[model samples]
Target: MSVTALYTDLSGYYDLMCADIDYREQSNYVRRLHELFGNQGKNVLDLACGTGPHLRHFIDFGYTASGVDINQPMLDIAQLRCPEAQFTQQDMSDLNMDAQMDLISCFLYSIHYNQSIATLTDCIASVHRALKPGGLFCFNAVDKSTIDNRAGIKRQLTHDQSNFSFQSNWYYSGEGEQQQLQLSIERTTNGITEHWRDQHAMVALTFAHLQQLLEPYFEVHILAHDYERIAPWENAAGNAFFVAIKH
Candidate 1:
């Protein structure tokens, strides 16, 4: 209940922040990838699974699903959203699993929440250890090298009599292994308005560096970041999906 800021006490507003995302398409794409390059099992572990939107779809798709997040408030909402699935409070960087998963996924670039390259390495290792042989680890990521500090995405929506505006962008200083996800939110209702801003630290790396980190534990494939199509990463885009199979 102490979630004070974005992804924390403000967990109740999480869904509103992501109302524009197409969860169904993202889920379907991952399922398609699993069918093409996985152990063909149904057990899945969703990392940093805020509000469990993807878990909802995964359960509906007949997978035995479980989710882990650092925010308990988010987990509470996720439990209500997908009562048939299991939820846990845990940091994904040092993930612990009771059983091996057939697939482990981190969506919306949440993998970067590990916050530092060293921690991200730990997360990758943890994912490798928690997955069964040939199991898949899938996630999307942005290249820090391609980050445009001046570019951002903004949207406005009306929900339950309240109007909400959300802005988010990536900021990289052109060096180092650090980046920031800068977020700003504004909500107005009946002449009352409130504002919130947060800067989330993230691990910054090139796809080449990330591939090197995964090579020791998995067979890695970098694919275009398109939920509608599965194709190799063209090396020209700022975002891409990483699909790794545990060796």
Candidate 2:
């Protein structure tokens, strides 16, 4: 699949569009999670590492980090941001690595790009194969309940020189096994306006389904909205953070 304008033409504006996200705090949380659940070593692989913000902080946190993204333009920016770390262009489902990592993290809900249960399973199994024994795979995901709750929501961000708005709507398709998201993005800069409409499809995997899929390859541990470890049923309606240890 070709890279969309959202990731290519709009790649430079991604950080600005998400200016509210505290990468430092998020990276600290991830580091803490790794400390609690990761192996002794600090070899880390960040999947779908857009612009390398987290990897920059991971390097600061004293980990040897590498990043992989399918988009070259995004990887280019990431290289400039984190020059010390290695970067690769690869699909998450077909992840290949020469050396195993102690920890692998895919953040920012990038797993949704898998678009199918089969591809998502392939990505997870690939991560399992790329990890050393007892290595950790940590990621964040939005379940169907949360997606349904937030459907048709509009979010906007404004900076000094530009204004950006995003509206999202999701619906079930194909016998309820697939979910499709339609995103409308509008940007205004220096009196110039651009509008882009993008569609993303993902497998509608519930919390229970996710647990079942990971059971064969990992010991799954789920966390709540605040990134603290919790039972899966505790925060069943919100975003979930997963820490799965390879068996």
Best by lDDT: 1
> Which residue ranges in model 1 land beyond 4 Å of their true spot?
1-4
Q: TM-scores for all candidates? A: 0.97, 0.89
> Per-residue lDDT tens digits of candidate 2, residues 1-247?
3226767877887676566678887788888877877778899999999899999999999999999998888999999999999999999899989899999998877877787899999998999999999999988877775566345767788877778897767665436556766778898999898898877666677777888889999999888756443345366555788889999
Clashes of each: 3, 0
Q: What is candidate 2's CA lDDT for residue 107?
A: 86
**lDDT score for residue 31 of model 1:** 93
Task: Please write out the lDDT profile of model 1 over residues 119-184, one tens digit for every residue.
Answer: 999999999999999999999999888999999999899988999998988889999998888888
What are the runs in model 2 whose C-alpha is more than 4 Å off? 1-3, 149-160, 169-175, 228-235
**Alpha-carbon deviation at 177 in model 2, angstroms:** 3.2
Work out how many backbone clashes candidate 1 has. 3
